[model samples]
Target: MSAPSRIVPLLAEGVLAVEGTAAPSLSAGAAQPLPAPGRYLVEPLPEAPLTVTLDERSVTIRPGGWSGELGPSRGGRVTGRARDDLDPGRDVTVLALATGGVVARATARAADGGRFTLDLPATVARAPYRTRLTIGIAGSDHVLGRVDAGRPPRAWGPAPEAPRLRIKISTPNLREAPLWGDSHFAASLAAAFERLGRPVGVDCMDAWYGRTAPEDAVLVIRGRQPVQLDPGKINLMWLISHPDRVEDAEYAQYDRVFVASDIYAAHLKDRGLPHVEVLHQATDAVLFGGVAPPETRRSAPVFVGNSRREYRTMVKWCVEQGVPLDLYGGGWDGVLPPGYLRAPSVANRDLPALYAAHGLLLNDHWDSMRDNGFLSNRLFDGSATGTPILTDPVAGLEAVFGDTIATASEPEAFAEIIRSCLDDPTPFLARAARAREIVLGAHTFDHRAATLAAAVDRIAAG
Candidate 1:
């Protein structure tokens, strides 16, 4: 297997259907073909973002030719040059999803997005692309493949139509940076919307330009960055994080506004942004739905998230209290003792199993988001998996989760929380079961989807 490599935005005219003839190759058609040292595809599309896969190797494309590591895109295999186009029989018309089976359209668009992510074209696409590329796998691990016989052309155009809503994700693709959460979050919600009989599709930020239909209501999962809004269609913004970056003018642009915090929604409403409503983050209960039997009495506290440069609250507390912690994420290099730092990230599809494997999960929040009263999605994810969780106290958490969640008021409280869980664990286990029931009932992505879907329906009707 080949190791991963990096590249950045290429101001490309179009996509080139290239394969890994050898290892992985990245060149500018100018950098002298990288001297053939490493195994890469090295071909230059020159004017567009290049995406390739090297066997089991992951690829990260960023700003430079290959350095920044902004995040990850889907890894692909150039295995035997995409087999010839074969329009298979429509025998597999039924899509088996978490919400049960649905007669999926013969067209190349997935109906139940929360379970089955995307449906690729049965034929090769040239341009005017509604075409979903490389990102072929679903959250449920199902894939939609096409029998493409045509080559990617160098032209582009736009289109519009049908009553539908599209989820705008921050991650460029599904198999993205291990810590990046938006794509999976969006996919979970998209499936829920489909279960309610609303047609939904997911798109990365870059795909918004030429592909978004004019009639489709756009749900922007506001996160670390901004995606441009098309005023012609019904525009909606759900401020999930980075509350400070969203200006008043931006809120004024959306027909509907959703903030993930109760206090933030109140603040917006008081500021006369009456469109704002409280829509907290959610989980896919069907996926992260069960508690697995313990492999060992492994009791080390588990925390999964990026370091974000500073020593996180939970890790800091555990360290000071002399408790062992199992950490997963990047940027914890100089701050941890040996054997404490686990893998930098777990894959999105693998998260359910990861959470299920743990005895206890610990979580914290960023100062900015925490101050804004925004709770992390892990709260929902860990709880949905029926894993006992200990987290830092925040406003509105108790109200949403009730005593189903165990929270600490300060660093000093971590000792008590940890000691109690290890000693008795019965109370915590009860809480976890209660939290799972509550989340599956009201806080799953389906619940949130129903809330937002009502608003979108009303706005679209007008």
Candidate 2:
């Protein structure tokens, strides 16, 4: 018999929950957080159950169970020109594979002119690290074509005479959109390089399988692990989430390694990682300007981040203290107590307005980020938006953000910070204004861009 189906709230922690029932145990980082309202995960029931709606975005079980989240926006897009001989009326399917695993699959009818586009789930974008594309008929298994579609956009703008420098950035894909919030370092850094009078190309780790940078390009790799690239002038911007685990041998291939924080750079330098430098995360002024209107401004404390031990501690403390905290990000649903308001993930572009609307923004870094004194990009983003923040204390935070951003070392201290921020707005607003000036003056993406250009120029000169 086919298994029965039940509606469950899907959480980032991988717990499956039915109404009025406890969630099953979830594994670390493998599970997604509890989805907010209007979202559901479909699970099989013990007994056979009739499914009434088996649509792509939702599934409904008879005897009253329904589950599913909204489908991906327009599916994963696959755009390629069709062959002149191919039938425009027939449907086509595009499949993305990584290490022989079906990562993303989508189907769409050919447009009138033989140009085809298919949208698959966004999860398909992250995968076996190498991108191999296969096109086949929608229903039949017959494969029609295969190609390694892993090229970064060849053109940034009109080509310059003897392109000054071609930098290919390799970073984890933050999100599908190229916005500052969901940036794959390549995209934002590309814009920065363009402003500095150099053309650049950007590629994410997922789509760069078996890919080699053009002979004339410099590969700027920024991620935890090493991405395979040919031997060249590689500048490794290592954002360490786990400093203790980083092996010097893994990074030996790169010529220079850039850490996001001074403390981290010092740590790696002491450990004998060659050519270590500091390149802190910063905010983009255009994206994070404190310009939200007065009517939409908020006064409550807002926390936006995914789960970690620190997050669990802070969120629980806030709940027990009866602090009216607003939570956003994934992996909290299964773990967090119900009735505490939870919001879906916010886009990077929307975060400035969101921060501007609130009186206080809460931040806590990853263990490595905190231990090694690496700053969270959210810090600069909040500061640039002129939003007051109460974050856990880090070694070098005060030196960079100064008194503009408050620090709370303990859970009790975090609670008190929330209470005080809400109890009176006067001092907090003043601090936020000061923080905005500091960010605008020395901590914007423009500043980072200049730093990046100078670093590259120095390397080229040497």
Candidate 3:
């Protein structure tokens, strides 16, 4: 027996099909028809046509069509098809841009095989100009393609009158802040040079020495690392407030040298360096502020530092003395005792808030031989936050903060100081407030920048 003649819907109402040789038909008055053998390209009216596939089991309908390529200029184009099987009435769109700005757009109907074209502006080969191109589908919001053009060169001028001062600190990475040290010192120094309208660059001393030239002045902060320098070039070096490194010949090449403390100055003088100056470190108030006296006294005390050495000792003492202590910083591992809070590593922006949350902040010195020249960044952070500090009796600590900071000669003495603060919190709060005022006035980035600028001027004169 011959197979029954089958029929399929020619196209949905209002849908136009692209001309093809093999097309399916459907039986009269049938709710559904058998599978169609050939492909029928169709465009729906008023909207992009949705394409439908018919098979033995089911009928599948999907929205829109493949994207098509636009022509290429300096920019290129993408093109594809669209479908709206159910509606049989839809419009398609093309979007384009040039110079990063929108240049043109085109809308077309899918009825005539859904073909469309978009043109892009030509690329400019000259410098000192800008070029960009982008294309997206209309109505659907899907981006088709993108292109970029040339950018014009920026104008240049003569270098500034102020000297270019490059300061170097010895550390592995520029991103890591010094533990138990003030990162603001380097940042403030850079800011200081900026305020004087001088060109300044700060980086690791080892890195700076790698790029050192006759024109570059080098300021080494507690840097024990070796640096290669050119002898004939005018170079200035400052040891800052740090211990003397064994690498004296490396430091001796600089034209002028400075030390922050008398002890450090004497050590450099003993090494017979030329034009050594003793300049005490100063702080900037503008960068670090918002530390006001607390409204009510609280017994909560906190300490921040790496859990390397003397931290366990300090924590043990605080616990033994029945004090509520909180700690923020890493390296604790299994070292922390019960009742101590471990705060996540604080960011520079959030440091002020962290300090303000506590009543007192403790500063501990490393006990190794390297500790001699080390000064705590916590000193400045505490001062900036107006948190009363109970620090170790380091030589420079008193000079840096004066009588504003309470010093502890020993672990027992440190515990006693905390006890007294807990007993009469008013004096501690007063001391913390005073400390903030002192740092703001003298120990800020602005002040350091000026100092650096003046030093640079003097070096240039000689």
Candidate 4:
């Protein structure tokens, strides 16, 4: 019988063709019969080759060699074009991998025609690194592509050796969308460690709830309500907003306790956890930097917080007082009055801009825990965005934001504060801008990481 026809396209450079029926068995010496199942193995190819196998019938090979270099260098350019068929809206994340695992990841938005270019960090070590791209599409799973980084060794000398600080976050997940208030804190902390060049591990304490032991630093961000601690480990508890007051005996197990506000720190001190420190919550500015437009200055007034009973009450009071408030966040649905504008939970990247979009931002503490000294994430977020904040008069609020935040003790006072913000906005705006400059300059993730690393170094030295 005649051999099945050779159904795959055999093209010279730049030629294109649709595939046909199955290719015939190779005569003794055809280019080692393009691997079985028609999958092209182009490692030997000078450039990565693109081969398409047609419906089990044939294969078409397009030989525009792939240049595997990933990302740009300090003085060099990292450039590449993605096929138009790739998802456009999704971010194309390029990960640089070393023998140890992913050393860095850079994300780029696909151009109108699906092209992408990224500026890679120059500090990466000179080693055999691989690059992989992942595209996360809405309503679908992420798609990935792999390429061999084709660049030569960087001329920079060997990377400096730094002490490795490993931080483990006991939480549900580390995604940008947090299920609870503490989840947001945990995610931010983990991201901070990563930014500081520390290897961070996030494990669901709910999965390993009671299993606790002395670790490098096992940070528990609101895992339990009463602030349970493990006597065996150097446990650090990060009380996101507030927690039920624990007995003195129970609070002694924590080596370090971090509270978002001085009120909470005072609560911890009152409860006998004297080692507590007031580390104001911070926005992931790297993420928020993506949200607000660079050219747009603060415009609308806004409020961000949980849409719980207390929050809804505040929203209603604002509406009753005829205040126009732009609301952005989840859970405040039925609670916000009819006239309020609701923005979906702002993306981390968009938060800075979101804060920047509003002239004034409001922060309200839970009425039940008002005396407990809790400052919500909104305080930090608003302050970070240089948006003046109008909040409940709390002990630490004034200290942290100073003149940037105006506080009111009652609903009527709150409304008046909002009016004042509207009537004479310059002073508040200037204060907010100064506050933002302070936090961005000194309280950023990098700063926090440096602090944590120094603490870890001290511990190690001892």
Task: Note the clash tally of each candidate.
Answer: 16, 15, 48, 12
Q: Can you write out model 1's per-residue Cα lDDT over 1-462, one digit (the tens) per residue?
A: 752332211211111111224343333442222211321223342443333344544342322221100112122111111110222221112121110112122222222222222232233233232222222111111123222222434221232333578877767554552346787788788889889887798877547556736446788898644555555566788888878756564577678889989988999899987688888888887788754645554576788877878888788888888887788888999888788888987777777777667668888876668778898899988888888888877778887898888888687788788877877877888888899888888888888988988887677566
Best by lDDT: 1
Candidate 2 C-alpha error for residue 98, in Å: 20
Work out the TM-score per prediction.
Answer: 0.63, 0.60, 0.57, 0.55
Instruction: Name model 2 segments beyond 4 Å from true.
Output: 1-185, 209-215, 219-221, 238-240, 293-296, 308-311
lDDT of 4 at 187: 60
Off by over 4 Å in 3: 1-160, 174-184, 205-215, 240-244, 270-272, 291-298, 309-312, 367-375
Tell me the alpha-carbon RMSD of every candidate.
Answer: 17.8, 16.9, 24.2, 21.7
The local distance difference test score of model 4 is 0.51
TM-score of 4: 0.55
Write the residue-wise lDDT of candidate 4 on 1-462 in tens digits.
644323323321111222223433221212322211321222332232234333345343434322122223333234444331333455544433322234344445554333455443444332244232221211111122222333443232222433343233334344523545555555666788887777665555333333344244456555333322323334565565445533343344556667766776776677665777776666666654334434544444677665754556557677878777788766766666565757756555456666777667777776534666666677766677677887776666667656767777677887877777778777887887787876677666566656655654543343
lDDT of 4 at 67: 19
Candidate 1 total steric clashes? 16
Candidate scoring better on TM-score of 1 and 3: 1
lDDT of each: 0.60, 0.56, 0.55, 0.51
Model 3 over residues 75-182: C-alpha lDDT tens digits? 333344433333436666555543222455666466855555554434432323544334555433233444444454422233256556676665545565544243
